[model samples]
Target: MANDDGMTYADAPLRLGRSLDIATNRYQVSGAIRSVGANASLPTDTTDVLLETGLPAVDADEVTVGDQLRIGGQTVATVETINAHATRDPNQHRVLVGLTLATISDGDTTRFGVTPVRRGNTLSLATDEYELDGRIQRVGTLEPPGTPTIRTVTLEISEVREDFAETFHAGMTERADDETIARVTNVDVEPSTLITTGDDGSVNVVDHPINRDVTLTTDLQVREATTGTTFKGRSLQQGSTVVLDLGTTTIEATVVNADA
Candidate 1:
């Protein structure tokens, strides 16, 4: 009988029987048939794709390894690894998600929420528990982290206390949790200039200096990761601010220069 495709199936069983006979004869000539084990397993199909989201770090932190991903109530993949990086916005983070493939239908697109899982596709990531809506900034294998190295960074603390500025010196260490992460190699202090604006919005610098500003040259050990070179979860780059904890006090300083 022919179906809608106009293909006859009346002799399909006979054809299958003949094909099985041919295979049996070949196997017999070669050797005894190997018994198939019930517990035999096939190789798993997995793809490492980058998933980006604008979710806050707190929410992004929820997507850990070994998490299951599903769409339309069907399991599609498993989370293998995750890395979170802060964006320009202090409140938002972009996350990388590595996924292990599962049951995905042909031509059926997988989506993180309503966003399709396509390269450069911007969408939010959603699971049964958390709905993290954002964009997929990248798609490919995750790059390995680079080796850690000691990098020189220049930081400036404006309008610092006179006593602290006078006592600040090289060999001072920046500590976090009682561990030193950076050491000051050089310290430069200059009189902080006082500026005033005129009625016409013109700026004027006063000759008299009131406060002191200290520029600190420090060496910080850092590693180049997918996000960037980070120390204590903060990116160490020009224009970024890092808080240094001295034994006596803590000071927030803006990075003016950073070594590549």
Candidate 2:
């Protein structure tokens, strides 16, 4: 990693883009692990590569203050602040990724990142960004919960979707009780996002909108005659999949008609 000669971090020996990897030495800040580097593409808002893995566990206790971390043989970042519920445990955790620069010398460097993992008193650092998701299988008759189930059979996809939101919605089957009732589950919605699936196979998404179809009807009744949400000549039914306006958003209903 090389920077212009004029710049300097005399106080902190760190910057971004400096090949920081797993097992790399780390500097601690606020009880969290962190490294400093310099990269033009790094814009704290939405970096293409988030060194913090997919999402941290939403466990407040798990995030140790004054802990150290690294990736790919190098130190990457330290836990600056945690912006989540402390008392409540969320399904996914988002950490604020900040490069630790004691001075300006560590800037303009290319480096790898590492994550801290602990299981039953065993703590190790990892150098991979991993995510959890799912696949689909076609199934029979619709009447699904809301989001389509992964199709288990052919010609009838179960409408597989990655559905993992919060834990409070774990055992709640309100959708199964009444088809007319509109229920919302806040969770991650794609294979890239973590989908909460128990052994029995249930799914829910976090903070997503329902049936925002330009071609589909707001009433959410699947029929050729239905006007608004008509995709592929058919209105959406429970457990059905339709490409919503170039496939930006996905809307799958559990039953054919919520009103029915």
Candidate 3:
């Protein structure tokens, strides 16, 4: 049932972002977002963006508070809180999500872009503009009025460092490899093992020389030599071109190996 405005809670027309949680099955859904206010101390420093998406009665039951939402593969927020409001019709309800921005850490910087906000996820809240570039902070669900099923999602979002001009272009590329040994280092290898031969008059013993030429190829995850973050591994793929930025000159190389 729709309100006097003829807009039901299920009538979210805009599509929000995608799920940040890669483990969950990916899904696409339409929803609405609004900006309430920000921290008074630094209002512009951090902003709050709210999202409301509806689910079918059956599907609403499966929606959890911790669920993730994303747009364009960039995680917007986690389900902070959920609310289901019953309409005049008994069979339908609305799911309102109070989503906070995802905290844009250094690790998130690479995958999300120089700046977290994307044009696709922007929303017109009152007179100001807001974007989805936050993570879910807290969430919970509430019982719907009457018999309608309901869910509630909440979020606490932080602001992204402004860099609208940094949006991706057709030829824009991110340089991953850094030649600074100070930050990154060559893979450490184990010392060679050796076996000694038995002396002529001494007890007889077998001696074997370990293979030294064998290159160490590991299937383990590659982390930053400095921060131990998964930023590089997450962004770069095998065959991807990598440019190591050193203060003096840039070193270009190909990604020989990579994995999730």
Q: Could you list the CA RMSD of all candidates, in the order they appear?
A: 13.0, 19.5, 23.4
What is candidate 1's lDDT per residue for 1-260, written digit by digit as tens? 55454333334422212322224432432222222233533333344565545567577767777888676576666777665544445455556566654522223555433244577765444586676454444444533245567888999988866776898899988543234678999999988888899999999987335578899999986677777887544577889987665656566789999863
Instruction: Give the C-alpha miss distance for residue 189 in model 3, angstroms.
Output: 85
In lDDT terms, how accurate is model 3? Answer: 0.33
Ranking by TM-score: 1, 3, 2
Best candidate per TM-score, number?
A: 1
Worst 10 residues of 3 by lDDT: 149-158
* Residue-pair clashes per candidate: 4, 81, 31
**Candidate 3 residues 109-175, lDDT tens each?**
3112223443224331110122222232222222111221111111111121223212212222222
Question: What's each prediction's TM-score?
Answer: 0.47, 0.20, 0.23
Candidate 2 lDDT at 44 equals: 30
Residues 30-84, model 2: lDDT tens digits: 2221443343332232111212222445333354433434644544333432222
Model 2 scores worst on lDDT over the 10 consecutive residues at: 134-143
